[model samples]
Structure formats: C-alpha cells, structure tokens
Target: METIVFPFSSKFLWAKYLLVFALFISAKALIKLPINGTIPAVIVFGDSIVDAGNNNDLNTVIRCDFLPYGQDFAGGVPTGRFCNGKVPSDLIAEELGIKDIVPAYLDPTLKTQDLLTGVTFASGGTGYDPLTPKLASVISLGEQLNYFKEYIRKLKAIAGEEKTNFILAKSMFLVVAGSDDIANTYFVLRARKLQYDVPAYTDLMVNSAAEFVKELYGLGARKIGVFSTPPIGCVPSQRTLGGGIERECAEDYNVAAILFNKKLSSVLNSFKTSMPDGRFVYIDVYNPLLGLIQNPQKNGFEVVDNGCCGTGNIEVAILCNKLSPSTCTDVSKYIFWDSYHPTEKAYRALVTLILQNIIGDFF
Candidate 1:
C-alpha cells in the first residue's frame, strides 16, 4: 500500500506559508555559514602537512601507507596519511562544506564528481627547495603546478573553455610547505648551510615561495591561501634530534620558522596591491601549533611531548609500523600522531583556527 505523508492538506494555506518561512530561515543560516557561495573546487599544493596520501604510490621510504598511521581514520585502514586521521587540508574542505572528504589527485578511484569538487596534489616531505623533493622522491611544487596545468586542459575538455575558466577563477588554492626545507635540507643534511647562512637560506625559501605564488596568480588563481611554516623546532622529531636528552624545543629551528613566517606574511601583504584582482592571504599555523605544544592540557591533550605511534620520540612514517610494539594504545590523548604530524584532534583544532583566519578573504 502507498502511504501518504503530509503535515496538512495542500488546500491549507497556513501550512504552505509556514513551510516557506522555515525554508527562508534555513537559507539565511546557510548564507551566514563559512561557504556562503558554491566554490568550483579547491586546488591543493605543498608538503606532508597537507598531503592526502599522494606519497602512497611514490617509491620512497618517506611514506606512511602502513598500519598505525591511519588507526583513527574511518574503519582503521591506513590510507597513507602521515597522521592517525585527517589532516588540515581535509578539515578545511569540511569547514567550507565543499566535501566531507578530500581525495588525492593521484587516487586511482577518483570520479568525475571528485574532480568537479577538489583534490590534493601535496606530497609528503616536499618543499620549495628543488632538492627537498629529490631527497624524499615526492612531487615538488613546480611539478604539482605542471599537473595543475594538465588538470586545466582535461577540465576544459569536459566543462568547456568558458565554464572551466569560471571554475578555476572561483575556486580556492591552498599552499602549505617549507617545513621540510628547513628540517631536511638545512638541519638534517646541512647541505645548503655551507653555501648560505641561516638568513640567506631563509631568503632563498621566501623567494621560491613568492615565485610560486606569482605563478599561481598568473594561472588564474584569484583566491590563494599560503600557509605559514609551523614551528619545526617543537615537533617531536626535531626535539629528539636537537633537544637535549630531556627533549626540549630547539630554539634555533623555531627562530628560522619565525623569520620565514614574518617575511612570508609581509610579502603576501604586498600581493594585495600588486595583484588587485587577486586575494593572497597568509594562513598562520605557527602560533596555534606552538600553543598546542606549550599547553597541551588547554587543548584537551595529555601527551604533548611525544607522538602516539612508536616511542613517539623518533619513529615516523614506516618506522611507526604495526610491527613496532612501542606504539601507544590511545591516540586521542596525544597531540601528535607521529614525530612530525599532529593527531586528528589537534589537526581539527588548528584547522578551525586557519578557517577562521581565512573566512573573510575566502568567502
């Protein structure tokens, strides 16, 4: 039997008016939300901080495709995430109501709808420095941009030139990199240190970043959000490497991050004038991340010093495998999921701050 459902008969004018009023209220609420308008897509670039498992397919040891990495993700299946769950990029997409999940650009299972929404091109351990990508065997920012160009061609074929142009112009582009440049290039190997001092090296990074932003602007990216480098000195891996046996935050590395962020913010500020039609806003992660590390309890974290995987001091990527008995049982209590990446809870908290900061420039 067919069941007819209705609050009132169509003949009841009051019921119809009440329904329309409710819809109007709901629409107003949606307009006040972060994403007041529909975005065509969200193009991503940068390193592991925003990588949505692009490294899984790459032939490199700098990967997190095994167990203990995505233990907190849906169904507990590892998906090459450096953390126990979603990263900042994923959270940002959710906040914008674009898509609850942001698939990797390289994901073989990606559908046409996924392309219509957004995808990530970020790879673990990549940076502005050319050698940084080489060292990790991951996609570099330059190569990522090349892929973006390819995507544009493919999208144009599907959506046509006019619609594709409109989509690309209306979409948001996010950049979060440079941590590996400092950690892997300068500190770990000390290769560039011989040729350039700390200040000079930072200048090189800022120059590369600026060039990338300008290139993106030229490619019709009107709304761009460039992420500031987080405090590298405070991460568990850096702490173990540079901190004393007690494991303290390395002040020198943090200073480099601070200097880079200062220069980056100022440079992006100039973009407002140089590219009047474009909106280039610097998203700050340093202060919030530092606060999380300094006062873990304030943010509902119990373990701020170490990660949840392995010993939490040195283990990361494959090192924090399921085979490792030292991996923590409770990822929720930890601020970091591994040596360099934060836990999902912490990432959610930090990404909210990032969203708040970009809401004005973005929506």
Candidate 2:
C-alpha cells in the first residue's frame, strides 16, 4: 500500500548497522564496569628478602631462629625471619589493609581458610638454579611457582572458579629473590669465574628469572612487583672480603647486578605490552638502599657501612647465633643486619620509599 524505497543497498546498510551495534556493546563493556569492592589478596614469592618464617621449618644453617632476629617484632620470639622485624611483603600487605603477615606455603599447619587471604612461597637462601647449594632444603623459583599453582587450585576449590579468578586478577604478587643466586652461586661458589663470562652469566640469570615470571603470569597473576638486586658488593661479607676499613664495594659484583636489573626491566616491559591487562612493577632496591648507605646522614642513619650483628664481618651463619656470639645493642642504627641482609630499620625505610612511589616508574 506504499511506495517501496531503499536507502542505498539493503545489504550494505545491514552490515553497517551490525558494525555500529558491535561498537556500542564494546563501549558499554569497557565503560560501565562493576567496581571490584574487595581488596586483592597478596601472594608473596621470593627469598629471605620476603620470607616470613619458612626457614623455621627447615634445618638451614643460615637461619634467624634465635635471639636478636625478631627483637623488633611483637613478642620477641625468633620467627626465622631474616630481619629484626617485617620484610617487604609484610609492609606491602599492611599498606593494602590485608593480613599483618604473609604465611609460608610450606607450613603444614596452614588451613583451607588461610588460602583465601594468600600465602608466601619464599624460602631463605633459595635461587633460580636448583643446583645452587643452600643453607636449608631450599625451594627454587620453579618450586615456588609450582607451590603457587597448588595454592590456586585449592583456592578455586574453596572460593569457586569465578571468585578465585577475581581475587587472583586483582591480587598483588611480590617477588624478592635473586640476591641469593648471586651471593651463593656466582660469588661464593665462584660460578662467575668458573662457568661463563660475566655478561653471558648475567643473561642466564635474568632469562631464568624472566621464565619464572612468565610461569606466574600463566597461573593468573595480574599484578606483579619484582625486586631488583640490592648492592651486593656493599654487603658486609663482600666488603669484608675486600679488606676491612679499606673495604670498598666490589664494582665487579655491582656491575653484574646492574646488568641483570637492566635486562630484567626490559623483559618485564615487553611482557607487560604483550599482556595489556597485567601490571608489572620493578622495585629498585639497588639505588634506594645504595643512596641510604652513601648518604646515611641525610637518611638519619648513624651506622652506614657495617652490620649490627656478630662482628664487623657480619658473620650470620650458625656461628652468629651461638651463646658467645656478639651482637650490637642498638640494631636500629646499622644498615646491614648481617653480612647480606638489611636491618629492620633499613627495611622499613625501603618500604616507605616504595609506598611513597619514589621508584614507581620502573615497576
């Protein structure tokens, strides 16, 4: 009963209409998203840098399971934590309004409910390589990732797939290993001299670390924070070996660490670009800690060069915990807690710098 009129061709018009509908749906999905109200659970994985008390369960000679280790912590009982107090993960968890401590994965006592909050897979004296001799029956980076996978599976069982995915998607991942790899494997074992040239060895270490990160990504880790190596050459043990008072930071070791960090940063950037939804951040412990050491007066620290435990050599193995072992009365002033670790005060300051976004760009 009407004159039939077509606006151009019906086929082309239908296609355009469909395209417009698709674009509208996409926009809606991107814009009108539901806000995630829950705080992301924090999962920690690394070495002593973030280890809470995993070494307590191990028979490691390199342990802090005695007096002076937990002097700054509540109750003052040795918790096998390397520092006098909380580690980096603990501080980050506090900032996130999560649990006060990150629980160890190997703790047989941990229950099903604990998995919801998150767990720590870090072990003291562990490394990327399994062959590297450690103080305890240490866990390698691969082992830590495997433990994380197990944790996620259990989490899925309890929280269900949808909720578990949401938690992991928004959760923070803190990785603070690699120092032991250099300290124990490269420097102590003399692998740097025996196995490969410096540059080649650095690449090997960084690549191994990168692979571990990729594995974590595959397991649904969306937010990651990786710590670059601190100034290893400046550690009391290394410096002691360099000759006391005349002690200088081993530039060779520091150079290797620098090279590793540079390569690690590059790799992380590429990884982030490939996975647009994921966030990868690097914690530059090297410069910030180095700055504190070089300019201790500016940071309100008194002792910059030596540790507060045992001797100036900072010997913190089994010998450091003996009855006759020497310990500084005031641990708050010293930068190094032992030969290779930081004092609680130093660690706290480091945490503050991170929370204040001093090194926010490299993440």
Candidate 3:
C-alpha cells in the first residue's frame, strides 16, 4: 500500500527544468536592445534647438512652458520643449535607443537614471556670443558648462569614478546654437550690430564656438558634433522682420549664417588634426533644412514660409502662448511649430538625416 520514489526519475526532471531555464536566458539575450554601439550617453549643449526644458525655471521670457508647445508630446503635456513635441535632443537619444527623452540637467525632478542616460544643458535664446544669453536673461554657454560640471559630479556619485570616465569619453556630445547670434543679436536687437560688421561678428561667434569645443574636450568629451546653424534668415520670424514686405527669406541673414558655418567647419577640421585623439565633426543642418524649405512638398510639408502657431510670422515664446486663439489643424503639414522653432515632425526628418550622416563618424 506504499509507493517508492526513484532517484533517476527525479534527476531527469531536474535536468529538463535546467534546459528550459537556459533556453529562456538565451532568448532574452538575443532580443536585448542595442541601446548604443559604443556611446553610453548623449550630452547636449546649445540653444533652443536642443534646450529640452533647461530654461523652464530660468527668469527669462525666452521660454515655452505652456500650451500648444508640447501638444504632440506623450500625455499632451507641455514640458517646456519649444516644439509641438520632442526636440532634437529627445529625438537623438531616441534614435540611439538611449532613451525616449533627454531630460534637462536643471530639471528639479531628474532621477539618478536620467543622469546615467544623459541630459541637455541647452538654454533657449543662448548662442556662441557672450552677450546673447545675457540679453535674453538666460543661461550662457559658460554657465551651461558649469552645470555640466555639476552633472559630472552627480554622475560620479551615482555611477562611480570609472564608469563616469567611460561615459564622459564615449558619450555623444552635440552643440547646436548661433542662430540667435545672427538673427536676434545682430539683426533684430542690434545689440552688436554697431560694434561689429557681419564678417567681424561671425569671427567672434566662431571663436566662441571653437573655445567651447576645446573646453568640452578638456572635460573628457571625445566624440563632439557641433551642429551648423540652419538658414536662420529663412525662419518665419526672420523673414517677417528682415525679408521686407514680401516676407521672403532674409538674404543677409543667410549670408552671415553661411559665413559662420564655413568658419565653424574649418575650425572643426583643424581640431581633427590638432586633437588627434578626439573626433570633432561638423554636422551640417543648413543644406538639408534649406532643401526642405525650398522643396517643402517633397517632404509632404505644405507650409515652409510660416509656422503653425498664430500669424506664424512674429509670435514666439511668450507671444505664442495659450491665448493665441488657434493652431494649425495639421502640424505635420508645417515645417515649424512656432516663429522660431521647428515642429516635431520637422525635427524627426532632420534628426533622421543627421543620424544617417554622422552615426559612422561618431561611433
């Protein structure tokens, strides 16, 4: 009336269980995300193009923390991104599988995980010119670097010294600014127009940009990509301001942008030779964006001359607020979200083109 247990049968069942466990482990490994090739994080610097909300708390009217700005973002919540959704900072991280969004280094709610992934120190209305941020009462490039230093200390605390070094060395670094320098400071505000001519002014901007890259390199960044300014004169606001009654692309603004880009490319080329260990790349957004503007229909964009918000001519930041009555019904059909910033759809296209061109050099 009693049953006897066999040791061989028990051992056979245990062997089957181990086999299944190993298979599961293998399957999981195979499907693991390729978050990055060699880069561990994506550190961003510069102006509104990549600000990612660093200006949200700053005492600057050069901010967009409410209504319509992030209408296309997850939960339709405005996170101070100057776009209808994610900006290039978020798009770049998303493309790299690093993260869905690159948090602002100054975001008070940032977590330790955000630091490990990356964060942007970019502030809207900032530029390579020292006076640019000052004029707007926003964070300057130098102040951004100071914030970066603080980020490094925090990262080291969370990730330890050795891992922090790896991240600083291998992470992708982006610098995107200068539009405000040419369009706002020199042209609209005339803050530096009387002191310096266009050629002299571009030289000043390039010098500042070059110095910034060198400082970043000294801080352990090796793979740095400085984005060329877009055709600033062609943006809706500039066209309205300087394009005369016809609202055409401001030719003079375009000229200054071209000059600055040429100098910037030259400086980056020189860095490649001088800083042999570092990879300094000049990422061109001018031609690609210009092509989009000149041939908007090619990219399914119907409105290249104006933004989706307000009159699409002058409203931006504080001006392009909730009280702006209405926004374009189809933001995807437009190239810009506000008078100055590109729409999320436009940023997606630009980011795709950029990654395709520079991924090889960066990795």
Candidate 4:
C-alpha cells in the first residue's frame, strides 16, 4: 500500500508563503516577477492533453501504455503518453529550454533531477467534473493535487527548503482539462443532463476549475495558466457519435464548450484582478484548435475531422491499438493522432503559437 500525504504542515513552507505575502503588502499591491527572474520549472495538472503517462500504472482501461502511442517518440518506445509522441506538457518544457520532457509524478522510474525540475500529475480520461474520472477509473484532479503535495515533499528532500520554495513560486503551472467533462460525462453519458442543463453544467465545470486554481495558489503556485476547453464537438469521436449523417462538427457540443470557455475566461480575469499577487492567465485553445480543424491545408494537415490512427472515426485509448488496421503513413498531415488527442506535430505547432503569444505573461 502507498501512503498519500495532504496538508502543508512544514513550517518552512508556511514561512515562505508569509514572507512572500509580506513583501507584496509592503513593496507593491500586486506581485510582479523580478526583471531577472527565470521560470525554473513547468508544473502541470489536468487531463489527457497534458498527461505525461500518469495513468500508465493506474488500474484503468483508459490507458495507452503500448504500441503506436509513442511511435514518434525517441526510440519509438511507448512512455505511456496518450499521443503519437510528446504532448503539450513536454512541448512547453522543451520550448522553455527547461528540459526535453516533463515526467509524470506517479512514474516509479522518476529520477531526483526530474522532481527538482518539474512533473505532471495529469491523467487521461479525467475532467473537472468529479464523476468523469470515476466513470473511467482514472486519477481524479483532487488525487493529482495530493500527488503534487507529495511531489513537493520529495523536491524538498532533494533540493532543501529554500530552493523548493523558490521553485514553487517561480515555476510555470499549466492546467488543461474540461473536454472530457462536456464530451463524455454530460453529453455522451448523459450523466448530468437530468440534474442540470447546458448552462448549469458549464457553471459546475467553471466553479470546479476556479476552486482548483485557488487550491494551487494556496499551495504556492504563483504563475498559473489554465487552458480553455477546445471545440470538442469537432473532434472525430464526437463527430461520429453526434454529427448525424454528414459527419460534421457536433453543434451542441461546441455550444456547451463555448459557454464554459466564456465563463472560464471571465473567472480567470476576475482572479487576475482580485489575486494581485498571482498571475492567472486563461489560455484559449478553443479558437486555435478550431482553426486547425476548419482549415487543415493551411497548416499542412490533410485530415482534420478524423485522426491519423486507424479509421480515425472513434478509436481512442484501448480502442486505438497496433492491432487496428493501420495508422496513417504521415502523421504530420493529420491534426489529430487519435479520436481525442492531437498529434505531436500538431501539438508542437499549437505550442509554438501559444508560446509566441503568452510567454511574456509569466515573466
């Protein structure tokens, strides 16, 4: 059995928080990164998009710890990432020149240096809604937070209290979730449809997302970026299930995502205004991804509605395997690697576009 740690009991951790608060109160009303400050690490949370193999060891069917998943990765060995290769977490870290890859916190083979830098706690098939992970038997966001706390302790052991505190304060935090909640739990499963309508369900998601961000702040994360839900209706799997005859984007799903994104952006803006000591940025991945799906050729992608794997209609997770007929010969020409996730090439393109715009937001 494994022991799970909760609560920030260390006096050193509390002292670090108090000291930073005092500095903010006396020196400035808002917190600002020092001119020479550098982001020491890239910490991540949320679902499949940023999950760096966190679900590999978990007792869940929602895993891709086998062939064809990491075919584009180094040595073509599947490291359990839910894509053809590196996901956004790895791309962001690589872009920042921090490291080539961001390891998962739950990975047993994680080295000390990996912890000292950063790691992801994201799991595939998870969402902001509590029930989403339950349906898939995956790690919940709350459990991911617990793992993060455990990670902090290990980081302290490796680098000592002072360096640990600095890394927590200076690190770049990324949150990418909500797609599964809308696509799987609410719409496809019809789990929350009876309890709440579209607007109300979106409210539940935004509230949960806001609460999660606050908890991260309580844990010493200062610069955090939360990605808005993509146009889930346009993803191949959703199109197959909901797009009727023509196999177009599912309008209802896109509407729900738009509702959530609007509220999420507003809430993040409010956080920026209220929590002056923290940098809260809402990253809009919706429009960028939507553009890719609508105009594939502009980005050198031939297929946008379907994924590069198999028939690309509904294959994902266990459904997407090497046993499938075949994968596309040229993954770069397709925006998505599976029914749910983008290809490494597409992720790299999106990360490049995002970094060009938001890199200055953190420091």
Candidate 5:
C-alpha cells in the first residue's frame, strides 16, 4: 500500500492539541456564571429605624442632617443620618457589596449615579396613615410607595425595561415602619384610644401593613423584607412617659406590638401562599432589640434605657438638633441615638443578625 504520510510532524500535532486545550480552559474561565447572591439594587420604605437621611432634604425639625449624627463614620460629618455611623439598611448594602449610602428620594441634588445602587423612600416619623400628624413634612407609607413607583419608572427610563425588571425581581425590598404609629400616633397622641381598643388597634396596623405589601407587589417588588415593630415601649421617650422616674416600659404598648407582629406574620404567610411571584420575608427586630435593652451587658451596650443626646427625655424634635446641642462622648455605649431611633452600633448588630441567616427561612 502507498504510504500516505501526514503533512505535520508529531511535535506540531502535540502543539496543536495543547493549544486547543488551553483555548478550552480560557473559554471556560471567561464564561459568565449566574450568581445566587443578592440583587443589584435595594428599595427601602419605612420610618426612622431604616431612614437613610430622607428627612435631611425636608424642611423638618425631625431632621438629622447635621453634625454629630454621623460622628463614627469615616468622614466624621453628619450626612443627615440618624445613627452615629450607618443604619441597618446601610449594613445590608455593605453585606451585599452594594452602595453604603442609601439615597434619599426627595433629594433634588441626587444624580443618576445615586440611583444605580438604590434609594430610600423612608422618612423619619412616617406611618401608614395620612391622618397622622405631620412630623416635619415627612412622607407617609403611601407616599413612599408612590415614590418607589416613580423610582421604578426612572430606572426604566435610564436602564431600559428589561434591566429595571431584573432589578425589581432580584433586588431586596426592605420596609421598616409601624414604630412611629405606636409611639407617636397610638400611645402618645392617643389615636388608638379614640378610634379602637388595643386589640382592634393592633389589627388595624397589621392590616394596613399587609395592604402596603400588596401594593408593593403590584408595583413589581418580589423579594420583600418587612421589619416588625421593635419593643416600642422600651424606647427612651416611651419609658419616660410611662411612669414616674422608673423608666419602665409600658407593657400595654409592648403587648400591642406583639399582637401586631403576629398578625403581620400571618398576613405575610398568606401573601406568600397566594402570590406565587412574591417572596415576603419578616424580620423580627422585636425580640433581639428587647433582649439587648433588657441585658445591655450581654450585647455590649452601656446605656440601654436612655438616649445619648439632649436631656434623655421625650424631646427629640428639631430643638434637639440645635447648633450647640448636648451629645455623648461615646455613642456606641448607648442603644438609642435619640429618643426614637437607635445608635449606629445597635443598628449594625441588628443588621448582622438579619444577614447571618437568623431570619433566613423567612427570606
């Protein structure tokens, strides 16, 4: 038989094979893989507990847009934030490698760059009802939802519909409200005393919260995280008002909060069952916060019952933010930053618990 000699040498053939293998490896390495991590954006709605300075731009006395508020931060300048450093939402973004600053919705100066990460519609002293007293021109939950809708529209306009959909579908939705409803409206303002009994009032709060969640789902929020009310009675302002110098928390308010949370959980479970596209998660800030307050030593907190600023009374209005307001030397030692909000250290601890699978099943 005529020998049909190969044109290439053995060395050349080996070299070709090696090149093909290298190419294969390079292609495998270059291919993008689907990530099972958090979404690119986070849309927050609620009260001061999660407010990332939404009230800063507002012409309100309840604003924290001044010095000493962000003292523990890198710049050591207040960014209108309520905490000494960062809040729970800020930490959540940090955990996900997202932006550390959650932009305020009404900030006229906010650029497109700010929107790429996320925005917070939460305002200090805001609640579900519009009937509540206007606390320094803050937005209500309904208004916050409307702002969220506008934000989605703005995102669509910039990133196109597909990108916006992806963001809403995968991004986390955090709602931390209802504390103001109890502290400001119900107990202090006596809105509940006028309208309904304790149990009835709790039902109303939970029902309103459920309705708000439903509205968010309609607006395309998929992964939802709702923070139930903390021990509202344990707040310094409430403690001061509850008794005569004992600083004892009002059990009545605490009981109402418990009932509200139970009902809210049930409503969330029902939503998950009914809405196939929705993922409603409940964050229990009540027990963890209460534990920290009851046992400050266990949580590394020093002043659990009093705020770090002012007279430690129920006077955290605009007057507290005066140019020469009194402030503590070490804010980390205090649980409450003001009468109504938590310190940055406390918020960080709470955020750590939320991100470390303590409430993972709900999410």
Candidate 6:
C-alpha cells in the first residue's frame, strides 16, 4: 500500500490540493535546518490544501482567512489554509529540516532573505482542469506555473543566477490537487463526466497531469513528489452530498480515485524516461486516509465522519467560521476540522507517515 509511487526521473508533480509551493520569501520567520534531513528547501504547488496564505489576496469566494478556521493555529488566525492549522506541506517542511510554514508567494511583505528557503503558491478550488479554478476564480495549475516562473526571475534578482540555480536544483518539490477535479468538476458540474465515464475521466486527469509534470521538469525542478488521489468519497462533505450517508464512504468516488491513481502512476513512470535528469515519487494517501476512517479508535479519533466546526456535514471555507451555529468543544478528537479538509492532528499523522515511509527517497 505504501509503494505505489508514480516514479519520475528528477522533476515530478503530485496531484492533490495540498501539493508543492511557488516561491519562498518572508522576513518574519527564521531560516533553520533540520538535524536529520538533507533538503535545502521545499517548494509547494496546488490548491487550498497547500495554499498557505495565498488565497487571502484573491478576489474570489473561495477565501478562508477568517475566524474559527484557524482556531487551533498559532494565534487562532486563519492563514488561508483549509485546515485547522498547518497543512501537510508545513509539517513535511519541518521534517525535512526546513522552516515550519512556507510563506505565500503573493504576500506583499516578503523579503529578499525569504527566497532562500521556499514559499507556497496554492489557490483554493483549483485543479488540473481549468473549469475548476475558473468556477471558483482561483489560480489554475497553469497559472501557478506562471507564478513559479516569476518566482525564479525574482530569486535571480536577489541571489546571483548561479546561487539561485543551485537552490532550485537541490530543493524538494511537492505537487497536489485532484479532489477539486472530482468535487467541483465531475460531481457538481458533470462537465468532464458527461463526455467520459469515470475511467475515461481518470485517464484524462492523468494525461493532463503528466504534461504539468513535464513542464515542471523543464523549469529546473529535480526532486519531485506527487500525491496520489485520496479517498474523496470518504470526506464528510462527500458523505453528505451523496445522500446523507454519515461516515459511510462513497464507493463510486473511491473507485474513480483508485482508477485514476493507477493511471497516474503508470503515466508518470513512462513520462520519466523522457526527462533523464528528473526524479518523481508518487505518494499514495488513499489507503492511509481510509485507514483513519475505518479505524478511528485506533488512530485516537473520536469523530472520523463529521468535522469539528458547526454541523461538519457540508460547511467549508467561510461557512465553517465563528458564526457557525456551534463548534465542537474538543477539536483534537476529530479527524476533520471542516467538511473537506483534515484536522491539523490528522495532517500531522499523515506527515509522520510520509517521513517514515516516503520522504527518505526525496533525498
């Protein structure tokens, strides 16, 4: 269950919302290295799951830099992360001996020194398909790449060309963003599903994703990690939307993810030979997330189906705010902080799984 990696050459792409980052630049935090990891920096890319604080500046309805969203965060302020606290990228960054949270590339207060490590460039409601981001008015994957290009140009201005080049070559990159494709595109709009069945739609996703990974490799990323499609059918929101089935996972969506992930792994493996200089790793989260759902007690979770905020059935983004009817007293016991995103505790557990099982190969 742990080794279904996509397997790229040097540069890669993970397909999930909480994926890789754009640029690293923030003067507020200290730059420190970890004791056991060899990574020089971490770059993130994707949607809300890994957005950091980029969405705060967006003129879209997908923003969540508001109350109760970050009740468990450092100072109880939402930093645009869809989760209760740090997302997976933040935890993985700390594990890799890098800084804790990656700054948002769109932040206006970023300093020259912040470019030395890494920064995030995710947008809420984004996906491999353009229709998803357009519907939510967030940055698309292609737009994120454009931002990455801009980031490289900015880094060249602060650090010399050679130094900037060295940093990018040595840094580890993570890319994630397929849930939106499922939730917003296929299920809600039926745009993609109308033309293709679940299997065909999954193939389309992998094909588009492969192109994105090739684009990243061409941009100088070497060590890349891609997130395998998680069991979106099991998320509290999906359970609610698919006929009010509490805690019961949606088998149809799970089947789509399984098919999509298999094709994604295969496409990535074949795409690698073309880029002999890049290396790709496909990290499977479906099994791990399912594990948490099925054995909540084993994982110390008292609530695995619903979230801690409000009703926890369908509320998300600004809807899961302080204005909600009522929030749970103990967020730690819940696996989810909201309808779709996992709780900070759950993200931490996933990070431990990656560090212990997948991150070793990144070095």
**CA RMSD of each candidate after superposition:** 7.3, 12.0, 9.4, 6.4, 11.3, 8.9
lDDT per residue for candidate 1 within 1-363, as digits (tens), equals 122223333436544644554354335331233423445567899998878788888899888888877877889878877888888777777766666667788877777667656788899989988889998888999999998888777776655565567667777789989999998799888879889888898899999999999998888888899999988988999999988888899888889899999999999999889888988888998999999888889878998879888888988887889887778877879998888899999999888776776767764
- The CA lDDT at 144 in model 1 is 94
Q: Which of the predicted structures, 2 or 3, would earn the higher TM-score when compared with the native?
A: 3
Q: List, residue by residue over 1-363, the lDDT tens digit for candidate 4.
A: 133232357777756655654454334312234455567788999999988788998898889989889998999988889899999989887876677899988888887777756899999999999999999999999999999999888877766676688889988999999999999999999999999999999999999999999999999999999999999999999999999988899999999999999999999989977888898888989999998887778889898888988999999998889987767888888999999899998898788887777767776
* Candidate 4 lDDT for residue 196: 97
Name the lDDT value of residue 193 in candidate 4.
95
Cα deviation at 273, candidate 3, in Å, is: 1.5
| Candidate 5 C-alpha RMSD relative to the actual structure | 11.3
Give the CA lDDT, 0 to 100, for residue 152 in model 2: 81
User: All models: lDDT?
Assistant: 0.81, 0.72, 0.87, 0.87, 0.74, 0.78
How do the residues 272-344 of candidate 2 rate in per-residue lDDT, one tens digit apiece?
Answer: 7898777788778899989988988776778766777778475764555645266788887788887778887
Per-residue CA lDDT of candidate 5, range 108-220, in tens? 66778666568888888887656552743788888888788888778766755655676787677899888877777787887667787878877778888888998988877
* Alpha-carbon deviation at 331 in model 4, angstroms: 1.2
Number of clashes recorded per candidate: 0, 2, 0, 0, 1, 29
- Candidate 5 lands at a TM-score of 0.85
lDDT of 1 at 154: 71
Query: Mind giving the per-residue lDDT tens digits that candidate 6 earns over 236-351?
Result: 88888863434577778888888888888887777568766777888888889888888888778989888888999989997888889878988989999899999989988877
**Residue 82 deviation, candidate 1, in Å?**
0.9
Q: How close is candidate 6 to the true structure, as a TM-score?
A: 0.88
What range of 10 consecutive residues in model 5 has the weakest lDDT sum? 28-37
